[model samples]
Target: MKYLRKLVIGATCLVSMAASAQWQWTDKDGRKVYSDRAPPSDILDKNILKRPAGRVNPLVTNEASLNAASPVAAASSPHGSASAPKLSGVDKELAEKKKKAEEAEVAKRKAEEERVAKSKIENCARAKQAKTNFDSGIRIARTNEKGEREIMDDATRSAEAKRIQFIIDSDCK
Candidate 1:
């Protein structure tokens, strides 16, 4: 029972440590930001009030500790650059997910643009064909709201030609 309790407690501690926020900083808009990832490079060191456990901030150098620990040793430490946050595996995963989301957004935008372009091209082609038919002196007929087919008069044909020309002007270019 004692051994199980100790194991459970240890596991909980490890989980909590992994979940705890490692970065805290005031953003440009003055909001305090708490994140498990490093603050953006634009954030000044003074704005970063907290960092993951043992990163040595160059801006707030501890003179005594710096003297005791050789510069070579600090640079060679497993934690990475003393002045910068060590990127954890979680940060890498998050970065990869963000990049994929951005790519997906770009692809979605490209697809929408292509669809709009295709629609415009189809509209332009149909309008040009209708304009050609109108110019060829063919009498066109349209159904009225009363469900009766009506032969177009000269005024109606000219008006229709104007509308088709407007569509061609807007979509062909």
Candidate 2:
């Protein structure tokens, strides 16, 4: 039981040590940076606010050369001051992709409308032909539910003609 308790205590201590291994520093941009590893080599040791246990401070002792203390000053000029991070507008490639997607959507909608219009035109032509068949007084045969060939009588012909005429009225324009 004592050995088990000792093992648990040792494990807890190890976990706590690992948790304290994080690095905390303030970047030139005034942003507080936190990471598991050390900051970039360009970052001066003075900028580091916190370091893991047993880590040596590399703060430059020589006051004679300010330039030797900070290499970041040189890199800072060509790229704007790191104190203010540049905010960029929307990416050009992303904007183009969005534009293409919108155009594709418009084209898809146009194609769908054209398909529906073609279907309506075909329906109108078929309805007009049916109307002509009924007006000509020719006998028309249809398949009944019993699978038998049945001749359309006057009443049936009139009803079918009315239905066809309704299709023509709705679609012919």
Q: Of the candidates shown, which would achieve the greatest lDDT relative to the real structure?
A: 1
Give me candidate 2's TM-score against the actual structure. Answer: 0.54
Question: CA lDDT, every prediction?
Answer: 0.83, 0.80
> What's the TM-score of every candidate structure?
0.51, 0.54
Compare the candidates by TM-score and give the number of the best one.
2
**Could you give the C-alpha RMSD of every candidate to the true structure, in order shown?**
11.5, 11.0
What's the CA error at residue 45 for candidate 1, in Å? 15
What is the lDDT for 37 in model 2?
Answer: 96
- Candidate 1: worst-modelled 10 consecutive residues by lDDT: 54-63
lDDT of 2: 0.80
The superposed Cα distance between candidate 1 and the true structure at residue 23, in angstroms, equals 22
